[model samples]
Target: MKVHIHVSLKSGVLDPQGRAIHHALEGLGFAGVNDVRAGRLIELDVDDSVTDAQLDEMCRKLLANMVIENYRIEKVGEKENA
Candidate 1:
């Protein structure tokens, strides 16, 4: 199974990398970008037997920082991103 973990900082958290990207965009003359928030995508190829509960645990335990980050788990069909 293919899984995508979308990890992002919680609201109100400071994102220096996102800010840098936003500034760079403006410097490149890409206007009208009011704000920018950045996040990460983690793609995993796990066995079919990996249950949803286990995946959730993986995110909670190690993939995301519960204190400052939020994560969404998406299960995708093999053909979807291929």
Candidate 2:
């Protein structure tokens, strides 16, 4: 099975990298580029027997920093199709 974890900053967190990208976009003459927030995507291939509780634990422990970030996990393969 495959696990896809998306980690993103919570609202009100300062994102300097996202700000820089926004400025760059503006410089390139792109209009209406309101705000940019950067985040991370982590993909893991694990045994088929891995449970949802275990995956949640993995995200809380390693994939996301619970203090300033939020994460959503997606299971890939047949589970996804279903």
Error of 2 at 35 (Å): 0.9
TM-scores of the candidates in the order shown: 0.94, 0.89
Please estimate how well model 1 matches the true structure, expressed as its whole-model Cα lDDT: 0.93
The residue-by-residue lDDT of candidate 2 on 31-74, one tens digit each, is 99889999999888899899999999998998899999999998
Best by TM-score: 1
Backbone clashes (count) for model 1: 0
For residue 17, model 2's alpha carbon misses the true position, in angstroms, by: 1.0
Candidate 1 per-residue C-alpha lDDT over 1-82 given as tens digits, one digit per residue, 9 for 90 to 100: 8999999999999999899999999999999998888988889999999999999999999999999999999999597877
All candidates' lDDT scores? 0.93, 0.90
Judge candidate 2 against the unseen true structure and give its global Cα lDDT, from 0 to 1: 0.90
Deviation (Å) of 1 in candidate 2: 1.3
Clashing pairs in 2: none
